[model samples]
Target: MSPPRQPLPHRGRGAVSSPHARFEPLAREGFDDGWDIAEEAPPLATDVAMEAARSIISRNDSPDIGFDRSINPYRGCEHGCVYCFARPTHAYLGLSPGLDFETKLFAKPNAAELLTRELSAPGYVPQAIALGANTDPYQPIERRLRITREVLEVLSKSGHPVGIVTKGAMVTRDLDLLGPMGRAGTAKVAVSVTTLDPVLARRMEPRASAPRKRLEAIRALSEAGVPVLVLAAPLIPGINDHELEAILEAAHAAGAREAGYVVLRLPHELKEIVRDWLVEYYPGKAERVFAILREMRGGRDYDAAFGTRLTGTGPYATLTARRFETALRRLGMARRGGLRLRTDLFVPPVRGAPGQLSLF
Candidate 1:
């Protein structure tokens, strides 16, 4: 017998239901007229579990991605953006990629220590390390955990280069460290402003910072002498696609020097999660949205092919690219190119006998 399915939770969240993983038996619940009604279900509380990661740095070889090494201080993001490509990763932990992925979070408390040790290794080479590649490092819980701040301290002390991408305004709290790094050409920040529409932002990313706050963050970072880049990511077709030029104009006016964009990518379980969200929130335009998405993905929900995954290969995709380029050029925004960080300033940590005297 299949496991019984439960009704979607009523909390202000993104996912509609937690469908069984592929490895688990499929099931669905049915309602009967004989059931009695009671009070509404209470909201689910966020659960954070600690994970002592053996390693801190993750290496990637994809040509499309810019950074070679990256770190994710948290496992599952609480931002709860329905279009997050990282949602499917939670299934490997035997958890649902829907609601469970957002509510059940994991924190790597020892990330700073692990990073220090790794950078101290003899074979370690200094390179730009990307933060928040998989999950936002400065999520709400980070205010108390301080794991991300600790990691930054280690990198700053070592003179290592680092790049951060986030939607959290909390990043401004670390201006003391980032300001110096930026002046030394060792740091850069990309603030993702998905949409200027507050209502749409709330419905899509239930727990993320408001759009205006993100814009303020960009301006603050820019004024602090940090190189700020605007990322209008996951541009949903027929939904927020119309806001492309408007987002760029807003970011540019807010002091962003460069801008980039990515079309909506629904990989693995994200397709179902996002579809459900659209049905519940945007019932009228759900079908039209899917139609445009399919047209961009070559008549499929998604195409994982390496070269064309980030930017699809179709008329709709081409049109989006053109529109973005045209807007960027007209706004005098610099095109994103190679961002080189200073590796010459790196100073590997020194660890020897406690009282050993140094010899020149």
Candidate 2:
């Protein structure tokens, strides 16, 4: 067995190190000698495993977000956004939610097939299914795998309403499908722009599309008739919070008709992951950042309260929300409701497909 040592930073990867999952019984770390002979951590190469998912659509009763159902094409995201709220989910697979969450991934190549089976079931009622609600559907690997593309094709063919949220420029690759669906009011897309500064964006979301590319994607999608919404998400206090208006302005210029925002959420193992990242990159501001985050989160790293989880509580979070609303009004955009998709147009995909359907 190799000596357990701290992993070094890998360029283009968001996580600084990989920590053991929460459920592990025995935890271990490094023992360094005075001579400093520890090997350097190599650049992480992404590896993907195929999962034959039994079902595709995921239902949630959470009151915060608009959607009731969502679909995740891949288990772990390769975008490597250190601040991703979905990071802790990797622990359920008995893997570290740090580096392993980005380096080691699983693709549901059978996702579209499974979705067809679910949509065709008797008493199946259609609602807007969210794509990329957890992990990005158009992550780099999808450029080759095309699993997301297949799922979109299935959704388009059946006229099923769907909405997509992504930070990838690769979403434009499916404009051929999304264009018609958007015009038909059966589909819409939300492009998440974290920051306008390329440098800050690189450090935060390493492998996701650059800030400029995302803006361009918004322009293209909008031109194709998709009701594009700019999602200024996970606004990190004392870090990128100051850029709220700028991000919205750029997206509005790029043709985004609506917008939304979510304050940073540090759930489960992510507290350590983000804390270490701040210490490394913004050491001077690290202390101040957490203080502001806690102030918004009721003196805690996170709160799961249904209504306030996405926004938060107290003055700082309230100020952020106020600024968001004010910007929307300034942009001549919708102040409250986001772009809604049409579920009334859905048609069953398959007559009788193999496998048991989702009970939801």
Candidate 3:
């Protein structure tokens, strides 16, 4: 028989406990007798492993998402946003989706090479490739590794249309690449700014760029002639939902041409992680917040259905959608349909035979 688990102390991370995987029937626990239990030590420093990937682009057929093809330069994000839905993907690597998902990272060092090879292949069709679709490409480690930048270099040389979504200010470092692409209508960027309150953002996102810094990035991107979109993502109920309008307003003032928002989504291991975070930081309102989410999700923690997953069902969901639309219309930022990224400019790489001159 397995012993009962003790609550893990908050360690400046999102998840409170690394619960055993459901595939395993047994669970482990820590026990104490009388003596005070010292606070849990901070997680170990981040460890990055280079991954040689055979393919860099991933295709998805999800009905709700905007793009069909995307690239993730890294596996596992260090931003440590408690509401991040991608955390559970770490379990597939036999790693804890809690702290391990943040501290243990993987980089696709061969991503650019693989991308060039794939693009050079015959019968290849070009479409707008989404960057940072799963894990952030501009996370802190990017300052040193620059794998994302290398991938951008390949994409730029090929004249491939690309869209980027990130919360890292480090993205500004690549203005030299994005600027030309943006002018050519081949690039657009969306900066995720969850909240304007520094304290709340600090607690919720931990290591991501500050709310104001993200705003600055938006402004910078706009001034560079790159179309900027502000994403007020993962709007937690009874938490940051009240600031929805304010976030959009701020983004518009920062020169963003478009805006988007995603309601909080908890799936698989993420459910327990978010719950733990709520109890630790907002114990008094935890129950109320969850109740509201349940109401929106049809009396459940989450609903993964195609149309209803991004925005929940029921009255609260409807109201949130209406509020977002109304705000967008009022701010004169309502976008009809989705923004079309240019594909006509794509130029496949030329692969010449060894020691042969190109017939230009």
Candidate of highest lDDT: 2
Output the lDDT of residue 277, model 2.
91
TM per prediction: 0.92, 0.94, 0.93
Each candidate: RMSD to true structure? 2.9, 3.8, 2.6
Give the alpha-carbon lDDT of every model: 0.86, 0.89, 0.85
Q: Rank the candidates by TM-score, best first.
A: 2, 3, 1
lDDT of 3 by residue, 143-257 (tens): 9999999999989988998999999998999999999999889999999989999999888888899999999999999999898888888899889999999999999999887
Q: Which stretches of candidate 2 lie over 4 Å from their true place?
A: 1-8, 37-40, 352-360
lDDT of 1 by residue, 1-360 (tens): 433343544566768766565555665555545443534446877899999899999999988888899999999888888898899999888888888888899999999889878998877888899999999998888999999999999899889999999989999999999999998999999898899999999888888999999999999998998888899898998789899999999999999988888888888888898888887788898898889888888899898878788778889889989998999889999865445789999987654554564352
- Per-residue lDDT of candidate 2, residues 1-360 (tens digit): 454445456889998867789987867676655545546557789999999888899999887678899999998999999999999999999899999899899999888888888988889999899999999999999999999999999999999999999999999999999999999999999999999888998889999999999999999999999999988988998889899999999999999988888889999999999988998789898988889888878889898888998888998877888898899888898743556778888878764445545345
Ranking by lDDT: 2, 1, 3
CA lDDT of 244 in candidate 3?
92
lDDT computed for candidate 3: 0.85
User: Candidate 1 local accuracy as lDDT?
Assistant: 0.86
